[model samples]
Target chain A: MNYRIWEGKSGDSLNSENQKCTSRCGMTSSRPGMARRSFLRGTAAGIGGMAAMAAALSPLRELEAGAFNSVEEMLQKHYKEMTPDDMERALARIRRQVEQRYHVRPEIRDIKPVEGVEFAYALNLSRCIGCRKCVHACVAENNQSREPEIQYIRVLEMPRGTLNIEQGNHHYDRPTVPDDKHFYLPVQCHQCANPPCVKVCPVEATWKEPDGIVVVDYDWCIGCRYCEAACPYWARRFNFATPKIPKGALNPNMAYLSNRPRPRGVMEKCHFCLHRTRQGLMPACEEVCPTGARKFGNVLDPRSPVSEILRTKRVFVLKEDAGTLPRFFYYFDERYPRNTGGEAPTWTGPEEFPHG
Target chain B: MGMILAGLSAIMPNLDSSRQNEFDGAQPGLEELAHPHAEPVDPHIPGGALWAMVGFAALAFYFVSQPALPEMPLAATPVVQASEIAPGKRRDPIKEPPRIRVGAFTYGCNECHSLFLSAPERQGPLAQHTHIKLDHGLNARCFNCHDRFDREKLVLRDGSLIGYDQVPTLCSQCHGTTFRDWERGMHGKDLGSWDLSSPRHVRLECHECHDPHAPAYPPIVPLPAPNTMRMGTPVHLAHEHKPEAGNPLAPWWMHVAGGDGAAHGPGDAHEQTTHHTDGKTESAPSTHKEGGGQ
Candidate 1:
């Protein structure tokens, strides 16, 4: 009770005694009393530090309040670890967020992989006309950013004599395509069985689904961009700024792992339109290809079109040297380009197949 | 060399006499290094000379960094008008085949063709059917596909009459591989769903994508090329490069080789093959014409 008076009387003596005691007890400070001037200086320095911190963080005040993640979202479990209840809560929160931003109640769902189905895609090289309808149609269906322009598919116009992709042109703006001297090669995420992107993910934000789709949980991503570097096909795209999609162009059919609106700084790629595929519908790209060049089906089903192609045609995957084991395949039918006169007499008439 | 050194020594009083003596003695080819008639180096450069040089360099850099004065915009190359390019048409599933109009009434083919017994062979361009340009290569004769007896039906190679919906059966006579591929849902467009369990899947018929008369897919204008990250210029702005720069759109080999001659021009082969195939088809009796020609 009288320690202040006693400490004043024995300040210099107690200072040395307390320093020894505090050093033995592992306490930091051994000062018996604070000087009026030192206390004022310390108070001023502490206030200045607080002011500096406030000024440093002032830019955050301009951030869109709606874009900020909720406490629940920040603390959400990884995609693989989430229980059904956790997923439902997440979906509900997403619905609220989407409605608030877009003024449209989206039919967002957590679509899961179907059992006993492994999706594979095949493209017929002979028929592809290099018309980039699939690219635009995918953008419309996927709700990708239009201003900064994120395209999942890149249709390369490859020269007839060589198959090197580096030699192909991505900026071909010919009025009409198939250009007579070139063939089209549209590339997207191959949904590799041995996905490098998934392997290189610092957080387990991205992983291969049971059905062979590589998906990213946007909420859990730390935006390190390691997976983008790992992809050989240049498939993954990073949102450098807040994605700006036209309000009317927003596709309301959202899926948690596939076509949902991605926040800025997450990695995204083609997920084989898992939102539609899981529900027994064709991917937007496959459905929109005017030439019918794109083919997608369950490879496990022998009767599927993709299975038939793999069984009959000499199909090859891109970047086979990378050992990606891509589910996407490209094949050529033994026929000349349509309307071009070099039609191979493989199965034209009785002259070729006399038994017929 | 002696005159230049004397001039340099007069201008640069700070020049050491020992260094001048060493230069004179050590270098025997000093006359070659000094241009015989050139002026000596001026040690009394202007006080503002360094600033002048710096200013000149800054000016040069500014000009270099500036985008070349937007060249007098040339009259733009006349690209195929966007309107001229064909927008590819998809067949409506419920739409019916063509019917002739006769005085405000649409009549079926049988209604007119059955009224007259026309010549078996085409005599000339018919005045009545001027619109039908028979350009199906060697299969140009009307009787080749249309049933002469039953004007409403198409005649297969076996002379069996088939409805318009059975065009694939007739086409399969020549395009066997395509027909088989179409049947397996590999060649032509399949709509709705990929799952066989879904009833919404529909396979387009042969005539759905191709005109039976032409049987060739027409060239169509492609959608706009991507301009992702604003890295690419618009198609109209693509004319910035000179034509002599080789085509920016051309294959990398063309740029390296500097001409189209480096590669086999497909157009040449295409023309030759067209002539050869047409000749072989016209002279059907000559089974070995293609082999003999080769």
Candidate 2:
């Protein structure tokens, strides 16, 4: 059977499809009978040539070593896709890497959410002192990139009377928090019931877990940056380069889906320390908080502190209009007695952020 | 078809084995599924999701029908973790109560107070404890805290003896609200499991934060400032200067002396009482703008 392949080019007349080929070769056809076999051969050769070139540079990849890790990482499956055997192999690979690089035995696991556990977190805006203890604790806990500085929690010090998060300062270096003329509001991943980040993820790399933690698989993330752009609270962070962490400082405790050492060009966000939380331990921030401002517990359990807080305290979420349905709540105590100057604080309601 | 179905059934012999090899805590029920898909599942109903739903519904019904009130735990256990440096490396000035140490010897109140150390001698001043300044809002007499009879225990107003561990009880006599809040894990630092079933949380003692004698927390060095990548620094913006609106082509030197930032009220460096704003006496805005922020 003789078939002609149409080369769609600019200014070609519609009747050009019937025009006979003027080539000297034995090919006398309208467009050209680009034999399917030849086309297939060309594709195979191109792919093979590329692979051969890549293989020729294998020595360089071996020399770098991390190149191999990157390739292996790129080939790895998402957490949901991995079978038990695959997970075992993945865990072994991770353990080997930690032992080889950090010279420390890490207990990295793919921890699961607990039964009858739906985690809820509430931060007492009145109690947080903007100490950054929770921030550092998170960095240390989650193996966040240190150099370019990826901090999940941003403790913004708002002037005495302002609900403007834009005006909130995360880098306020102070001796103590709850400064007389300022209030601190530390914001991190709200882990919304309907997360825009999860929705916008092109690779399906990130998803909300059973325990209300939104987790990202660094391996599966193509780093298209759609999730980062979609996040309302600026919760997600991307590794622009290979995340540099001092081997000694690398947290031995890690989770494959959350805090494991990520390859360059992957997105990571706070997952509420799934490794610890699954084992009935508190998240790093809650443990290190000097003021008992952060309250986290199973929302399903009515007796849990977080449930009590939600019921008793006048709770509010950031950007309720966005309709992300954030699980994280920010609440203020009834008594904010400390007021500066002659003007009173613009605290209209307990649910309202400090509005000027 | 029968053989294939039987083979599939045969693969599930371990159903009664309580398989614990699931990754993290993910349900083992996923493996039993005839089909596996990579797309996100309804996490609300993971593996064995049907059974879980049934169990939850049953529990809900039981709780709704029961007249006996649900019992709340005394306190949720906070999973204790090392703060600052590791447990071994932390100086931890006061774990609970302040203690006096000289050379290799640690001293109790009895070490000094027994020798002619009656209540009358406190006003006369002593050779030791001179460095101690009782500045905790008026209740500052030596015997107000220290037991007059027993050298080791604290003396409550009603003459009850309280140890260092029970210092909050003694302090609660005056600072009732804070004490109440502290007990409920609101005022002070606490570590542990947020689970209702976890053991009692370890609450930080009153003296862990406050100085017993001074009782006022002195200003300490701040943590390292965050370089929030794209977000930049979190400096309180005095005014948002849109380059197009303001003098975009302002001389580079003007920026050093403060940009046409909000068109200043006469760049008079001397008259700006604006900051002394930062407790310093010298006329600022004349020299340091960035340095003062740190």
> Best candidate, TM-score-wise?
1
TM-score of 2: 0.63
Question: Interface RMSD, candidate 1?
Answer: 23.2
The TM-scores, one per candidate, come to 0.68, 0.63
- Give the 10-residue window scoring lowest on summed lDDT in candidate 1 chain B: B285-294
lDDT of 1: 0.68
Docking class of 2: incorrect
Q: What lDDT score goes with residue A172 in model 2?
A: 56
B1-294: candidate 1 lDDT, tens digit per residue? 334324433433243332333322111111212443333222222224334434544554554454432332322322223232322337543233468787999998778778988654643567776776555665656777877777778788787888777778888999899888887777888888898768977778877887766666667778766654122223333332211122344457745664234533322221111113234311111011111100
**What shift in Å separates residue A298 of candidate 2 from its native position after superposition?**
3.0
Candidate 2 lDDT tens digits, A67-111: 456455556777898988888888888888878777889888888
What stretches of model 2 exceed 4 Å from their correct place? A1-65, A68-76, A97-105, A173-178, A337-356, B1-128, B195-201, B233-294
